[model samples]
Target: MSSPALLPLCLLLLGLAAPVLAEEAPTPAPETPAAPAAVAPALERSQEQQQALMRQLPAEQQKTLQAGDESFLALLMPAARAKAAGTVVLVPGDGESADWPNVVAPVRQQLPTFGWQTISLSLPDPYDPVVAIEQDTAPADTDAQANSEQAAPPVTGGSGTAPAAPTQAEAGSGEPAQAAVAPVDPEAAANAQATRVLARIAAGIDLALQQGASPIVLVGHGTGAYWAARYLAEKEPAEVKQLVLIDAREPQGMPPRLDATMGKTDLQIADLVHAPGAAAQRRKERAAQKANKGYRQIDLPVIPGDRAAEQEQTVRRLRAWLDRLPPAASGSPAAS
Candidate 1:
């Protein structure tokens, strides 16, 4: 009934009202699922335990070295004699502190008595959750198999015919077969860890150089030996004149085993192995010796009850070996 001239004004009013109506309309709220439960950080727990142990170390002997953003704990034992022959940088194996209970701590504390300064390092833990999770799930699969066997009727003898192959659906559904399951690669994580460890070792070596410890020696116990040998072979540092490995063993998932590293390097190497059950290690060392003329292999007797005597014998043998090597150039500092 409105006039034609009012039509344009009416359309404009309706257009403006459309937005207002929309603004008044309520929108349905988005659904959010419940939050996940909190889980404790395993790495933090391990660090806390190490920190507690570090705090208990002697105030004078305990020292911290910066490696990237993280600070590593080190224990320094001065030589007992007036003039130190040379400094020995000790690297402990996995889950071992600067002053580990076994070979690491004993060597560090006792070597000082023989006129050699010792610096021991605390290394990272070897625990890998990816590997552990795979191992834990294995038991559950075994239990399921046992249940299936018990549920089936017992047969006096096995049938001549073989069981039928699994269907596509059966194979794909539920938990996958052990052989079908693809294990998570821990190589990246392990490489990162190795890098961090090497940084710490370099820092320790720098400190020793600053202290004027010439003709420096790198001593590694257990898997620590692998790290030490690898460092010398890879870096080819001139300051480190000798490499000593005590019961050296390669770490799992690490490339270029102990023997491979030893064989490639031309540095003065003393490969010490604990007798009995060390046949493989001995054979590897012998092979390396053929390639490296400077290599020397020493077989150490393991005394079960007399640990003190065993360590003394070890120190004596190490001292004799060091005495045979040419002394550092007179008036030459290690840093140079």
Candidate 2:
């Protein structure tokens, strides 16, 4: 009914009014379901009773467990939170059944109090994704036939030192080795592959240093101690700070050459041999008939033959060692 001239004016008013109203009433935002909160791992979710229930269940029979302890535990020690001024790598003893978790739990529990970072490294599993580490390689100096003749090459000085005689089985001289084992070359063919492990551990030490650590202490349990010693003796003699040998598992004595080798470096050796009473003293006496350095017999009061006892015994020994060590150098990781 409006005139044509008025039509343009009305259209302009409608456009302006519509925009104002539209501006006032915004379109409802499309409903978005809030992202589901990231869930904690099953183990963290479960109470202690639940964790016990999980252990009782056979792996085949387990009904979709929420989280297994080991896998779930990955959350605890992420790289950011893993800064440690000192580290304790708990190396397990030789056995078919390598109990990694049993070693980790107690240390994990105590590590934070001491302001330590603990790594429970799984020793190389043969089927592990890692490269196949050659146990002993032929020396470059020897010819193929000569090398073949020496299956397990005896260790010789590498870094500017004199070579020594290879150890023969102790029984040969009309007596068995101190441990009553046939002396298979006293030094296990140096695993050139373990050289890789030491490299990785060295990287870890470098990382700890990057973060804030002063001295990263190396604690080798059982035979692991020997490896640490050998690693220090052979490879980067200066990389390591302190060495704690829980109990050497070497069936034969640590080759005498190791002391002479380590003596050249700044390495200090401390031994907490199995047990250190009269009977153990005899064992110690017999064991020492072969060593060149001081071997302290660390007495273990409690023998944990059972799983529970083993856990307790390990904790007791570590605490005792920490308590017994003399005051360390100022501002050093060993100071703790």
Candidate 3:
């Protein structure tokens, strides 16, 4: 039985005590879930390497060419002579760049001096499931390490060590924790790569046409040769007059064999084979079987440990073959 004035003071004291009690016992915060792991794309490594190479190339030669929804870098070199002979579009194979040191770079660079403009295209990576999986798993591994560190419990008491993280079984989950990665489809991947490559070639050809470069010639090295021949067989563009293949090779797991594609195309072809290559011999036989009068095989002596000499030899042969060609026909852009 307190007095009325004392009653108000007692209520005020209780109000203050309520906050103090709450401070003494706080509500635990909700635990945050771990972040999902990062998954690397199949093309990530190739694209990164291409970007690095792009930086090293001359700024004036750089050209951004669009193919479908994607845009890739190319190098456009104008002919050195006042009167252009023709435009040679160069395509490089897998694990190679537009300025590849071997056939692609030497031919692209040297051909210009002989009055031929050159356009070099960058190709997509060939699909390799094992390589793709290994490359993609690296990012996941790094993300897992970060996740483990972040999910670890804070240090407690005298031990000064963080408490062990709860295993899936310890947390009452029967299944093991895993980062899920989307599966890549092989056929779909191949089709996508083919589409991109063909689009790029078409774009390059269109560029050559706009610049009024006549008698377009497609030059391919390694697997790049396969794509060039395929383009000729499939598209059958009226502008292209000749084809050059340097150590032609078909990409593994892709359709339409190189020899088979070459047989289907009706353009003049020069098959430059580095000696001792059995594959080139087989390709020559197949072309002969098809009775392709326009096809001819030229042997290049392999100069081991002397790449410069080999490239020079190749360039000299190429120059002679090109010089032998009859000048562009009457209606050609060069004549116009």
Q: Give all TM-scores, in the order shown.
A: 0.67, 0.44, 0.73
Residues 60-171 of candidate 2: C-alpha lDDT, one tens digit per residue: 3222211212221111222224454455544443331122345445654565465555543333322211112221232342333343344354455666555433334322
The alpha-carbon RMSD values of the candidates against the true structure, listed in the order shown, are 15.4, 25.4, 11.3
Candidate 1 segments exceeding 4 Å error: 1-40, 43-49, 127-184, 276-291, 329-336
> What's the ranking of the predictions by TM-score, best on top?
3, 1, 2
Give me the displacement of residue 155 in model 3, in angstroms: 39
Reference-based TM-score, model 1: 0.67
| Candidate 3 Cα misplacement greater than 4 A, ranges | 1-43, 129-184, 329-336
Ranking under lDDT, best-scoring first?
Answer: 3, 1, 2
lDDT of 1 at 287: 60
Per-residue lDDT of model 3, residues 163-226, tens digit only: 7667444356543455646556666667888898999899888888876767788888988999
**Candidate lDDT values, in order:** 0.74, 0.45, 0.80
lDDT comparing candidate 2 with the true structure: 0.45
Error of 3 at 62 (Å): 0.7
